[model samples]
Target: MRRPRPIAPAAGQESVWDYPRPPRVEPVTERVTIRLGGDLIADTRRAVRVLETSHPPVYYLPIADFVRGALVEADGASFCEFKGAARYFDVRNGGTVRRGAAWNYPNPTPGFEALTDRIAVYAASMDECTVGDEIATPQPGGFYGGWVTSSVVGPFKGDPGSLGW
Candidate 1:
């Protein structure tokens, strides 16, 4: 697949095209929050953001940051070439439950060990997800957990016709 041309980022913004292929996992101090059905699922000043070429950032909050009993382990697992095996969870918010809405790598690959026990939720499954003060837009596919915020520009991977990107 041909790489799409990256949009030029404005001051203080990042272009997804500039991210790396193997992905980089790093700490982000911005407060991240996730809410669903009027119930708070998570709120944290600490999160790990994974940056990969063609994709928006996917934020992973510590499992401890989530509300008690909010994540119920689900069956089936998938492997990420960079992150290793992932386990899914059914996210519960009050009376609402979104199946396989969250996942984690309990044992991440060598360079991505920071992801162990961290939970990454699909923004589309949440009533709201925010990075700092900015509300997040879910990446345009059900399979990816990336969230698009104004600070990042993208001809992102999940959009239609980007399947081979």
Candidate 2:
């Protein structure tokens, strides 16, 4: 199978190809906002982003930034090779409820300690999600929580026929 070439990044853009294979965690100073249903549930400048090759960055917001009682543990869990066990959360705002809308690693694996207890929401599960001034488009598949922005270029993973990437 022929490998897809990544798009060339413009002057201010970044190619996901340059992101590392094991992923890297870095602090993001840009504002991150999340709205569920019709309510603003999270707004924070203190966030971390995990970047990996062929995938958009997944932003993790500190749980302290969420509204009181806005999140409740939902009944499902998953495991990641790098991040360890992840627990799901249902976000409740006003009268709207989005089940399994967010996830977090309670105890991340050795190199991913920055992810512990920080929540990463699925942008598709929210009414709106933004990073800095740009609204984020959810990564192509439902299973991966990556936020795609104009500054990033991709032949991104998670789209149909991209699993082999």
Candidate 3:
């Protein structure tokens, strides 16, 4: 399939088109915070991001940063060709419970071992998710966990009609 035209990024922004295939994982210097149902569930400065071509970055936070009882292992699993098997989590805070809203790879592929102790949540599942001081928008579609911020531009992969992208 022909690739979609990429949106040109501004001076301080990155085009998702420029991200690599097989994805690249790197540390994020900004603070990551997640709030759901009026409770702070996860907060951490030491986070990692996985960037893939045509996709916004997927941020992963250390499991130790989550509040106690905030993440309950849900009954579901999925396999990622690059990251290995992932298990789901039910995120809870106050009266809210988002089932399968987060996931972690207990035993990741070789290059992705850094994710073994990390969890990635769907931004839309939380009332608020921020990177640094900027609020993150969830990437289109329910399947991807990419977080869209001012730093990245896209003709992203999960948009409608992008199934073959």
Candidate 4:
């Protein structure tokens, strides 16, 4: 692994800082399982089967896989062009609640309506979660689900940033 270094500006000359990150888009579709409070929170009962000719599929899991009654319904919502509108939830543990930390498509578009009852939440707030056999630790710091191994013009921490120069 290569370490990042900071460069100082040369005297009286314009200096620019650029971090050249290779545009990575791995076509990943492996089974994963997540655990919270010692109970499996989510599992891929089926592979994330999507095609090169179609939009990707994110198969969320039912609440059964998680610790019983650990999630509280939140007031957050979002819209997707290909997956319709989504609802959100807050994860509760020991009187601490992570606000609006997860979201899921309730009534998705016709192309992805199969995830109507499934939920996809942030993998950071949980006590623990897994993707495949890898038990993912809390992300460095972000709100979006980092479980999906794809990129969309990052530095993406907040809302999707500018795409045009």
lDDT of each: 0.93, 0.92, 0.94, 0.49
TM-score of decoy 1: 0.98
Summarize candidate 2's per-residue lDDT along 46-162 as a digit string, tens digits.
Answer: 999999988999999999999998899999999987778999999989888989989999999998999987999999989999999999999998888999999899988987789
**10 residues in a row with least lDDT, candidate 4:** 49-58
By lDDT, the candidates rank as: 3, 1, 2, 4
lDDT of predicted model 3:
0.94
Model 1, which residues run further than 4 Å from truth? none
- lDDT of candidate 3 at residue 50, scale 0 to 100: 97
Better candidate number, 3 or 4, judged by lDDT? 3
lDDT for 153 (candidate 2): 94
Check candidate 1 and list the clashing pairs.
none
In candidate 1, how many clashes are counted?
A: 0
lDDT of 3 by residue, 1-165 (tens): 888999999999999999998988999999999999987899999999999999999999999999999999999999999999999999998789999999999999989988879999999999999999999999998789999999999888789989998
**Superposed Cα deviation of residue 87, candidate 4 (Å):** 0.8
List pairs with backbone clashes in candidate 4. Answer: 32-132
Q: What is the C-alpha lDDT profile of model 4 across 70-116, one tens digit per residue?
A: 67788968875556788888866556567886667767766665465
- Using all chains and alpha carbons, the TM-scores for the candidates as numbered come to 0.98, 0.96, 0.98, 0.57
For every candidate structure, what is the RMSD over all alpha carbons to the true structure, in angstroms? Answer: 0.8, 1.0, 0.7, 10.6
